[model samples]
Target: MFKKFSPSTDISGQTPVKSSMQRAIRSSILSSWNIDAETLEAIWPKKESIIHVKCREHISIYTLHNEPLFFQHFDGPVYPTLRLLHKYPFILPHVGIDRGAIRFLLAGANMMCPGLTSKGGRLPPQDAALPAGTPVAIDAEGKEFAVGIGLTTIGTEEMKKINKDVAVESVTYVGDELWAVQKL
Candidate 1:
């Protein structure tokens, strides 16, 4: 979806997020993520209000001090920018892709099941299975930081069973246009 994202042409307006909405977001974030209060405050301070940066195609970027933290496409789950995921690695569940698939992912290709089900790839165990459409941090084999953020197209067990098709739909990656916009 962000294959050709150009901020200048895509952004429509910037507005200060309202306090009520801020509380809603704050609580929603707190409830949705596994982060502690201290960590959440450090990322989004109570004193600094979040800026709602509107873009084309119903994309809403939430920022603080001009640095993009997370974004939402339409009303979908909030996806932390790759930068944010790098800082607080445990906020979301993870799905790892093999080294061979890193190049394809960097090129903005959707992840196929083989890349994630192979020896190098990693997925949650059956006991910790995640449902479809869950937000996930995509890690690379032997990498400390996540390479991308995406939504699971199917359950982990399903991916293991059906290993030929797309597994995770890439939302944002390390070299995508969204990753380039660190500020504004």
Candidate 2:
């Protein structure tokens, strides 16, 4: 793994993490994909930091071997890597059709007056997990269309007005589960 590739370590000489906190992170991946413990350990960065998992994989700190392959090969019975972390267990970013409109917003979306541009219905309030620069998905009336990417902004209104200069927030996913399955 070191000849053709080089894994990085911080100044303290710690290896990458094996993300093993947060029941949401682990359970979502395992229950959805039937992943095992050994597999989860192999792909994660081997760190024990809460912030890293909360903000998704620490892409800046330790990158995957090949993210595209990681996703493609693993999109099986379970959802792809991104959906595993974005839905099911996570409470912050919720996906639901609020008041008959399919709205994908953060969990604490303004219910009384949902600032939805399109479909808002009876779906859950889970943050749609979007890849950076990719469109998020919203399904209403059996139709699925790509919405704008989930923003770093907190509310639906702020997301509409985000400018090019705004700082990018990290996207979350379960790459470890994919990697583990791929290795098998």
Candidate 3:
């Protein structure tokens, strides 16, 4: 989504979020992700204010102190920015791809089932199976940090069974335009 993004042109305006909206966003994030109250507070303190960065393509990036924290595409699932994910690695579920697919992913390609079901790819076990449209962090094999953030196009088990076609749709990657914008 951020492949050709230009901050200067794409960003429409920046405004501080209302207190009521802040409470709603906090509650929404708390319920969707597996994070504790203390950790959330640490990332976004009660005193510090949040900025709503309106960009092209219906992208709404929420920032704390000018750093992009999370974003939403229309009303779809809220995604933690890659930087935010790096700081709080456990905020979202992880899916690993083999070294062979790293180059493709870096080019902003959607994750394929074969790459995920192969020897190098890793997916959550059936006990923790995730449904389609869930946000996830895409990790590279043997890498310590996630390379990208994406949403599941199909369930984890389905990816394993089908073993073909797209599994996850890439949203933001390491070298994408969004990552280049550290502060907004």
Minimum summed lDDT over a 10-residue window in model 3 is located at 25-34
lDDT (C-alpha) at residue 64 in model 3: 89
Best by TM-score: 3
lDDT score, candidate 2, position 128: 34
Q: State how far residue 25 of model 1 sits from its true place (Å).
A: 1.3
Looking at model 3, the pairs that clash are none
Candidate 2 lDDT, tens digit per residue, 1-184? 0111123331123243345523454465456443466665554443533222111222222224433111211222212334333332231233333334323122212222233333543223336332233212232344343221222333443443442232222222222222233211
Least accurate 10 contiguous residues by lDDT in model 1 = 25-34
Which has the higher TM-score value, candidate number 2 or candidate number 3? 3
Residues 1-184 of candidate 3 have per-residue lDDT tens digits of 9998998999999999999989988998998887899999999998888999999989999998888999999988888999989999999999999999999999989999999999999999999999999999999999999999999999999999999999999999999999999988
Q: Identify the superior model by lDDT, candidate 1 or candidate 2.
A: 1
Q: Is candidate 2 or candidate 3 better by lDDT?
A: 3
List the global CA lDDT of all models: 0.92, 0.30, 0.94
- TM-scores, all candidates, are 0.97, 0.26, 0.98
Better of 1 and 2 by TM-score: 1
* Per-residue lDDT value at 158 in model 3: 99
- lDDT string for model 1 (1-184, tens) is 6778888899999999999988988887887777888999999989999999999999999999999998999988888888998989999999999999999999999999999999999999999999999889999999989999889999999999999899999999999999988899
